[model samples]
Target chain A: MTDPRLAYVQRKTRRRLAFSAVHLVLYFSFSLNWSSWGEPLSHRLGVTQVTGSLLMFILLVLIFIGMEFLFLQMESKETQE
Target chain B: MKAMFLFLLRSAPLLVLSGVAAAAGSIDGEVEQQPLNTTAIVMFLLFVVMTLLITWRAAKTTTSSAAFYNAGGKITGLQNGAAIAGDFMSAASFLGITGLIFVGGFDGMILSLGAFAAWPLLMFMFAKRVRNLGSFTFVDVVSQRLARGQIRIVASIGTIAVVIMYLIAQMVGAGKLIQLLFGLPYEVAVITVSALVLAYVAFGGMLATTWVQIIKATLLLTGVTLIAILILARTGFSFNELLSLAVEKHPKGEAILSPGVVFKDPVQIATIQVSMLFGTLGLPHILMRLFTVPDMRQAQLSAFYASLFMGYFYLVLLVLGFGTVAFIYGNPEYFDADGKLTGGINMAAIHIASAMGGDILTGFMSAVSFATILAVVAGLTVSGAAAISHDLYAQVIKQGEPDPKTELRITRIAVFVIGLVAVVLGIAFENENVAFIAVMPMVTAASVTFPILLLSMFWSGLTTRGATYGAIAGFLSSLLLIVLGPQVWVSVIGNEQPLFPYDYPGLFTMPFAFAVIWLVSVTDRSARGEIDRANYHSLLVRSEFGEKAAGEGAVG
Candidate 1:
């Protein structure tokens, strides 16, 4: 009654967890640097407090997109393997 | 894993600082004063028309029960994702959170952030399971390994509880928003929203609701983004300056950033967070969206997209809330004759928009708000209807095959019935505290349905007896607790003091439900090896990657 499918699923699960772990590290490191970069841009952009907040928002979104892209790439490699 | 920990660690400090900032606000100064404008009227009409058009278009294609209940299973991952975003981004997110943040500061954003954070967990936990189940109701997913009759009874309770709670919250919010923005009578607003949502669901079914949600989500995101940009433009792009402005206007300047300054009660903050985060993952209406997508991968992808969309929208709300705080404090016009913030806290979004964007933008924003209400109600109605027509009536009662025609008729009728029930409930409970009521039902649903659903998918030992008993136990305990819980007793029943410290039952009830299911399953020897291995495999793996696999099978 050994199910090959179960083993396959277990392997997939492990790989996904590994991928997720890598993603978490990248996002955390990137987010820390974001505020420092955003502060200088806020001054240079001469936007109001709210506008500066909005720009920060835009930056966060960009970073999220990059992370998602990285995730997709990782997923693709796993699928190929 | 490391990345997630890092993300959490980085966010921890900001969250703490923000908590401190929120506590300094006095309830009196936190309210806004603003005049209602003509723009709100135009926006209302626009949403009404948009809803009608979408419903009419949906009616043409929704010729069968499947179409009505599950959009005939035709919706793409992207479309469904947008719709999911639309459904989740209710008037509460657009208006309530913004207003709460505007008044309460960082504490409000914490609620928003916590709710948004639940999306990824949902993706990981439920997305594949639900999509694989391929059933129209949460009952279908939970009942796959259990007896049909038992699943129906337990699931119906969970479904009704969540829908009723959610409907009441939306109706209350709609009534207040209508009165504030359009001078409509509260009763009239409630009836109008109920009727519009009913019509949208009845005629178009899931197709109409899905499109409406997609459109609404797009508009809401766009509107918030635009408003955020406008606010930033006014502030000269300085996050610190915006904080300074907010600080200067307050008596307890800079203290607004500190936690406990606004809410003062740590328990209340914790309660709000738990209810928002767990309640989100458990919501039947939200989880039902997974079934509408084409496959498991799409289901997962849609969730990811929804998280991104919701995360972005919440960030804008944070800015909008702070913008309102900074702008509205000095304005005498925002106050009523008694000098109380003229409208309830929820009106801050409209008031801020009116002030910043003038009449046209205000009108546009109001329309979007109206659309938000409409979109959310439509999603709720469709889910409710599916529970009745697809789960209870067709599957459990008739045991009929879900032929295209039967499903369509049943769905439309169910939509009408569910809509009627909501309207009646809304009318009767018009005076109740809508937010509190809404959160309670979601907790009940989450406590009951969430465990049953997860166990049915992953736990092979789960038997019909176990699932049935567990779901019932979870459903009753959560409902009873909520009804007798201090929040309900004091707030709804007008008791002087609450019996329980925590408002949410999830911290207790959710775990209890899972424990009951496990215990019951383990005790029943007959339950072992009950899982239909072939069926489960087909349901989960084949449905996800079967197209290519099917081709190979044919060659063999």
Candidate 2:
């Protein structure tokens, strides 16, 4: 964290770590919660047959693809500095 | 040693055939013969010809160790990403997972989700740094900071162990798949896949392997998309209807859409997630893909693309897996006399293809699967060969200075030997439940390679002795647990109770390794350990910035 370049990299790394944390939390919550909570994912959404299980899966895929895209964009900008 | 290796390799097939027949409950059994479908044969032949052409072109350019190891570092982000996807979509995941879904409904989705759970983290953490530090292998990055020779030897052992286990899993799956689809004998199926892999890796090396992977990924994605579309078309393109239809037909009833239908244990769920998330980072073949790209941006982009493709693929699998329940579950045609799937649950993917598109589609899927096995094993072979030649032979045996010619020669020899071993082992494990072995590499990777690589790169205080001990500790603990886990003990050994209750080893093993490395490093005050810690500064600088910061080569 001494050199300016190194400091900048650290700043970017913090953001990456944040994203990773959210990812792990979201994933573990969706996957492991069913066992302890008695099928929380089975609850249906408002007026639709689409259940929480399907919703979680879609949310995960979106987050997976979206976060990686966002990270690539941010990293590209940072490296240009 | 060579004789013993060959002897073990040669005896592998016979051992699998007998499956310890002297014992009553061993794995040895009969393989149901498949009909000789000429269409499937034609499709598979076409894939083989296409692969041979790719290898022919690649062989001409593979002159040096660099070219052989990483395709001379000229691959693009898009190409590398597809290649990474190709590597990820092994026959085991593509077929085995769908099989799980076909039987267990929403429960089988544990693996489909578990598979891609690691990617964003891998992208956010390791991708760019790995590209910046290593040339041929990930060990290059580790050796940059630690004792080069000893660490490489240690890492090379780790890599080979992971690679060999992974290779056998794919080989056995491929052999059975080939027999089931193409009506070839088990031995012929194994040899055919191995021989083609030997050609691709020995002569064409990474370039051919990468292209083949890219090609296979494209085919697999295309095939999956077609089947998904057809399935959706049947249900008027509504996922809810598909789910409803699946529920109506599935024996699990409404549980098909609910969790805990397949995996009810909290420990099992946690273990599966942990292993998939961490073990992915340590897979040698997957990690090796980062170096194939020319620079860091490409490396990051490739991971992005890989996750995109895989994510898309997995979502599509939910549809197809449910579709198998909707269409294939009650279809007695696909069932044997015992009321099981004729080729087992894995055939759900292919059976669904037939339900929608008939024999031609089934043939196309079979061919794509054949290509998937070949590309994955080819990728594994090159990485395994690199461990043998680049890390073990060059870094350790030659003290880090290797003649280009000798190294390339050794790599090619290693490729042939590895291919032979895979073919033999494939034949040997024909009747065994190779699913455990298929996932073994991921567990092994989580324990040894993943921890060492992460500590060496990120943890400033990691000394050589600490890292080595961590590896040995991680590997031994994971191995012992797996041997005692339900898969081996209760299932394979017919024991009443498993010493290790869970199959996934990462939850216990990875943290244990990190702790061991931490304790050992903190306790060490040796002079050499001080140097190892001190080297962290240069390693960090070079990894974040570049070696010289002049060109793309230096701009990582």
Candidate 3:
């Protein structure tokens, strides 16, 4: 069996890597929305450029806040335990 | 082949001379003089006098290192937010983005949004943890678990590199702004601004720096808001009317409302946004501001308020940029005899200001932009000084046992030296339009320091060697890539081809730095590595619940 210390370290590293990946994906997704890649989303739906851009901006902020809130909840749970 | 060889031989001397010119840093060309605007001079002096008075007051209150570096952690959330806005809204954002919009049209809106998008990530990811962990510098957080001496040296080097690069860019921009507004010689303008920044940082420290930023932010916000309101008023508060007018007046017509007007490549777009996002994350001066707030909650509030102010200002920039096209497009008065922008394209927003409110309001806006440059340079200088004295001398060299008076004295001396160096470099680069030079240091920070900072905060496997190597990789790669990039190769060096085509290098280098740190740290089996691994749980707890992890009976 693997040492408990090594197993713990592996678990923590995976957690950190996962969280960082999510962070990267959010930023990248925001970039896609701002780029020509997301042009079809607005064009096909008949959304005006301004409304589409504003919606993207609002969605980005909400997602960021949600992620933070989720982490804070985990921290609080850890403290209670 | 013979004819081509003959042509090459004939043009060899001219090519050689151009290369020589590039080496001499003479590519930017000299600023042409216009009649001095006395209104601008008077308004600028008025601002100088007020900030000097605030510095004198701050000098009295700055009695200890804590007060000088982080203002004793007493600044209110709202005030800190304004100061943060002042710090980030920089000459590049105020003048450069407006200039881009003036010239590039719809492409300018993307640039403005790039500036606004970074703060959400900072507020959500790093601000509270940064505030909770460090007292003065971001390096403080890294030194908490890692070996202090080596980590401090690496972190300090990164901080100083970012500051110097940023300071040089701001100084040159400041000189050009003064030259346009007051018709002062570039050297004289650079020297004057540099000396004033030195005096501000040397006398008042962070307290003075914070207040200067606040005042500058308020002035800028008011100035830009008025310009936007005036632009809107001219259109009867109608966005559709403004858009139609701008499109009708612009040379490109409806194409000015489209994205491919400037940026055509998707990779380039993604690279620019990625650099900006990561760049803000690792900027030493911006992170230093977090430590000046009272607690994590205040720190979060600081980022939130800054985002609001910045978002509103960027919207204003968009309108003003398009508005300039509406009013001043093809207008001979705003252009020189060569059909070039009279004060260069960076003065697009200023021309809009003049058109909106005439000489009086133009002078106010000019003074506000000048104040913006000064406040930014002062912040950079103070932080550079701290890197040298606090990080290098007191912490690294002296092992945290330097004489307080001597260290403060060294910090003051460093400030003066940094200011002088900036002035000299500013004069040499007076002709270059490196307003995008601000982007360079941000990319560097994101590539080099942000990885180190993020990994140190979150990763248990982060050893001293891992952190050091990771940062070195990031630093060297960013510098090498930027030197070979189009900005330096084609624009500055007047080369035909760039070794690295992309202007921003963060997308590739930031991830590479993170990978290097991970690979090295996971293999590290030293005693220190094991201890650091064990320390991660506590760090996370502290990062999350503030003082509760330390058994301090739960923090507010």
- The per-candidate count of clashes, in order, stands at 34, 0, 1
Best by DockQ: 2
lDDT of 2 at B433: 68
lDDT of 1 by residue, B1-556 (tens): 2232233233332222222111100011121223455677777777678778988998998777767777877788788879988887766566666665655555455555555655665665567667765467677766554566666777876787777667766666666566666766768877888788887888888888898889888888888888888888887976667777876764445444433334455445544555555667777788888878776667778877887888788877877878887887667766555444556555668778878887777778877776777788888888887777777777777764556576667777777877777677777876654434655655666677777776666665666667777777877777777667654777578888767655566667777878888887778766332543223443445433432323111111
Sort the candidates on lDDT, descending order.
2, 3, 1
Better of 1 and 3 by DockQ: 3
The CAPRI classification for model 2 reads as medium
Off by over 4 Å in 2: B1-31, B548-556
* lDDT (10s digit) by residue, model 2, range B1-556: 2232233233322222121110000112223557886888898889899989999999999999899999999999999999999988866566666666776666666677777777888898888888988988998888887877678888989999988887777776666677777787878877888899999989899999999999999999999999999999999998888888887877667776777555678777778777777888898999999999999889988999899889988888888888998998768788776565676555668889999999999999988888888888889999999999988888788876889899999999999999888877877887786656755777788889999998887788998899999999999888888889866887689999999888667799989988998999999898878888887766777777747323212111
TM-score of chain A in every predicted structure: 0.41, 0.76, 0.66
Please give, as one word, the docking class of candidate 3: incorrect
Model 3 regions more than 4 Å off: A1-27, A30-36, A41-81, B1-32, B431-439, B548-556
Least accurate 10 contiguous residues by lDDT in model 2 chain B: B18-27
- For model 3, residues B325-356, the per-residue Cα lDDT tens digits are 78887677886554566766557678899999
Better DockQ candidate (1, 2): 2
Residue B412 lDDT, candidate 3, scale 0-100: 85
Interface RMSD for candidates 1 onward, in order: 7.3, 1.6, 5.0
Ranking by DockQ: 2, 3, 1
Worst 10 residues of 1 chain B by lDDT: B20-29
User: What is the alpha-carbon lDDT for the whole of candidate 3?
Assistant: 0.73
Please give the distance, in angstroms, between residue A60's alpha carbon in candidate 3 and its true position after superposition: 5.8
